[model samples]
Target: MTTQELLDQIRHKRSFLCVGLDVDLRKIPGHLLEEEDPIFAFNKAIIDATHHVAVAYKPNIAFYEAYGIKGWEALRKTIDYLNKNHPDIFTIADAKRGDIGNTSAMYARAFFEDLGFDSVTVAPYMGKDSVEPFLEFEDKHTILLALTSNQGAFDFQTKDSEGRELYKRVLETSREWKNSKNLMYVAGATKAEYLTDIRKIIPDSFLLVPGVGAQGGSLEDVCKYGMTKDIGLLVNSARGIIYASNGKDFASAAREEAEKLQAGMNAIMRQNI
Candidate 1:
C-alpha cells in the first residue's frame, strides 16, 4: 500500500493500531487444534472479530518458521485470505530480513510479490545496499529497524559514536539511499523518549512501533513524542491481544483488547486535529 492509502485508512478507521498475529498453535484453544490448520484458524477468528478495529496486521515470520513447512503454508494461506477479503488492511511480513543486494532483491519479491504483503520489516545493520534492493519495489514499503524495544538495543543503538547515537545516524544516512521516500522505520514504543530526536531526523516518515501492552510501553508516551502531522505511527500489540484468552472465546477477547487500543487512538487523533 502507498503512504496515502495507509494515511487514508488510519483516518477512516480512526485508528493506527497494528495487530501482530504472532499466533502460537500450542497456546491456542485446544478445540482449534482439531481444525485442519490451527494457526490460520486462530488468525481467521481474530481477524473476523477485530478487522475493523485495526489498520494493519503483522505476522512475525519466526512464529510460523519454527513449525517448518506446515507453518509456512499456513502463513501463505492466511495472507492470501486477508488480501482477498480485506485488501484495505495493511499487511506486514515481520520478517526483519536484509542481506547482500542480490539476496535482498529476492527476499523483496518473496514478500511483496509472492506473499502479497504490503510491507516487510528489514534489519539495517548491513547498511544501504542491503536495504535499497527492497526499496526498489514501488508502493511497497521497507520498514527498517531503528530503535528496537529489546533491552539489548541499548548496547549499540543509543551508544555515542563520533558524538551521534547510532540510531540517529541510521535515520540520517538512510535518507540518501535509493527510493528512501518509500521508507518507514521500526521504532519501538519502549523507546518513547528517543522519538523526539528520531522525529528531528525524519519528521514525516511513518514509524512502525512495537513493544506496547505486554512489553509495558506507554501508548500515551509514544503518541506524545512520536506522532506527526500525518499521525505517523503504527503501534503494535502482540501477545497482549492475540494471547488474551486461550479458550474458544479467544477471538472475542482479542477484539475487546483491540477495541480498547482503537478507542485510545481515536481520541489521540481527535486531539491532534
Candidate 2:
C-alpha cells in the first residue's frame, strides 16, 4: 500500500496501532492446537477480532521460521487470509533481513512478490548496498532498524562516533539512498526520549515502534516527541494484546486490549488536531 493510503486508513480508523502477530504456540490457547493449523487459526481469530481498530499487523518471521515448513505454511495462510479478507490493513513481515545486493534482492522478491507483504524490516549494518535492493521494489517499504528497545542498543546505537550517534548517522545517511522515500524505520518505544532527536533528523519518515505494553514503553511519551503532522508512527503491542487471555475468550480479550490502545491513539490524535 502507498504511504498516503496507510495514512488514510489511520485517519478513518482513528488509530495508528500495529498489532504484532508474534504468535507463540506455547503461549496460545491449547484449544487452537486442535485446529488444522494452530498458528494460522490463532492469527485469523485475532485479526478478525481486531482489524477494525488496528491499521497494521506485523508477524515476526522468527516465530514462524522456528516451526519449519509447517510454520511457513501457517504464515502464508495468515497473510493470504489478510489479503483476501482485510486488504486495507497493512501487513509487515518483521524479518530483519539484510545481505549482499544480489541476496537482498531475492529476499525482497520473497516477501514483496511471493509472500505479498507491504513491508519488511531490514538491518543496515551492511550499508547502502544491502538496503537499496529492497528499496528498488516500487510501493514496497524497507523498514530499517534504528534505535531499538532492547538494552543492547546502548552498546552501539547511542554511542558516539566522531561526535554523532550511530543511529542518527543511519537515519541521515539512509535518506541519500535511491528511492529512500519508500523507507520507514524501527525505533524502539522504550527509548522514547531519543525520539526528540530522531524526529529532528527525519520528521516525515514513518516509524514502526515495538516496545510498548510488554516492554513498558509509554504511548503518551512516544507520541509527545515522535508524532508528525501526518502521525507517522505505528506503535505495536504484541504479547500485551494477543496474549491478553489464553482461554476460550482469547480473541475477545485481544480485541479489548487493542480497543484500549486505539482509544488512546484516538485521544492523542484529537489533541493534535
Candidate 3:
C-alpha cells in the first residue's frame, strides 16, 4: 500500500496497530494442532478476530522458518489469506534480510514479488547496496532496522562513530539511496526516549515499532516523541495479544487484547490530532 493509503486506514480505524503474527506452535491452543496447518490456522483466527482494530500485520519469519517447508507453506497461506480477505490491511514480512546487491535483489523478489508482502524488514549493515534493491520496488516498503529495543542494541547502535551514534548515521545515509521514499524504519518501543533524537533525523518517516505490551514499551512515550501529524507509527504487539490465552477462546482473547491497544492508540490520536 502507498503511504497515503496507510494513513487513511489509520484514520478510518482510529488506530495504527500492527498485530505481530509471531506464532509459536507450543504456545497456541492445543486444539488448533488438529488442523492440517496449525500455524496458518492460528494466524487466520487472530487476523479474523483483530482485523477491524488492526491496520497492519507482521509475520516474523524466524518462527515459520523453524518449521522448514511446512512453516514456509503456512506463512504463504497466511499472507494469501490476508491479501484475499483484507487487502486494505498492510502486510509485513518481519524477515530482517539484507545482503550483497545481487542477493538483496533475490531477497526483494522473494518477499515483494513471490510472497506479496507490502513491506519487509531489512538489516542495513551491508550499507546502501544491500538496501537499494528493496527500495526499487514501487509501492513496496523496505523497513530498515534502526535503533532496536533489544539490550544488545547498546553494542553498536548507540556507539559513537565520528561524532554521531551509528544508528543516526544509518538514518542519515539511507535517505540518499534510490527511491528512498519507499523506506520506513524499525524503532523499538523500549527505546521510547531515544525517539526524540530519532524524530529529528527522519521526522516524517513511518516507524514500525515493536516492543509494546509483552516487551514493556510505553505507547504514550513513543507517541509523545515519535508521532507526526499524519500518525506515523505502526505499534506492534505479538505475545501480549496473540498469546493472551491458549484456550478455545484464544481468538476472542486476542481480539480483546488488540482492542485494548487500539483504544490506547485512538486516545493518543484524539489528544494529538
Number of backbone collisions per candidate = 0, 0, 0
C-alpha root-mean-square deviation, candidate 3: 0.7
RMSD values for the candidates in order, in angstroms, are: 0.8, 0.7, 0.7
Indicate which candidate wins on lDDT.
Answer: 2
Please provide, for model 1 over 159-240, each residue's C-alpha lDDT reduced to its tens digit, 9 standing for 90 to 100.
Answer: 9856998988899999999899989999998879999999999999999999999988999999999999899999999999
List lDDT for all candidates, in order: 0.94, 0.96, 0.96
Q: Where in model 1 is the C-alpha error above 4 Å? A: none
TM-score attained by model 3: 0.99
Task: Name the lDDT of candidate 1.
Answer: 0.94
* Ten-residue region with minimum lDDT total, candidate 1: 160-169
Candidate 1 at residue 164, lDDT? 90
Candidate 2 lDDT by residue in tens digits, 17-113: 9999999999999999999999999999999999999999999999999999999999999999999999998999999999999999999999999
- Per-residue lDDT over 1-273 for candidate 3, one digit per residue giving the tens place of the 0 to 100 score: 999999999999999999999989989999999999999999999999999999999999999999999999999999999999999999999999999999999999999999999999999899999999999999999999999989999999999846899999999999999999999999999999999999999999999999998889999999999999998899999999999999999999999999999999999999999
| Candidate 3 Cα errors over 4 Å, as ranges | none
Clashing pairs in 3: none
lDDT of 2: 0.96
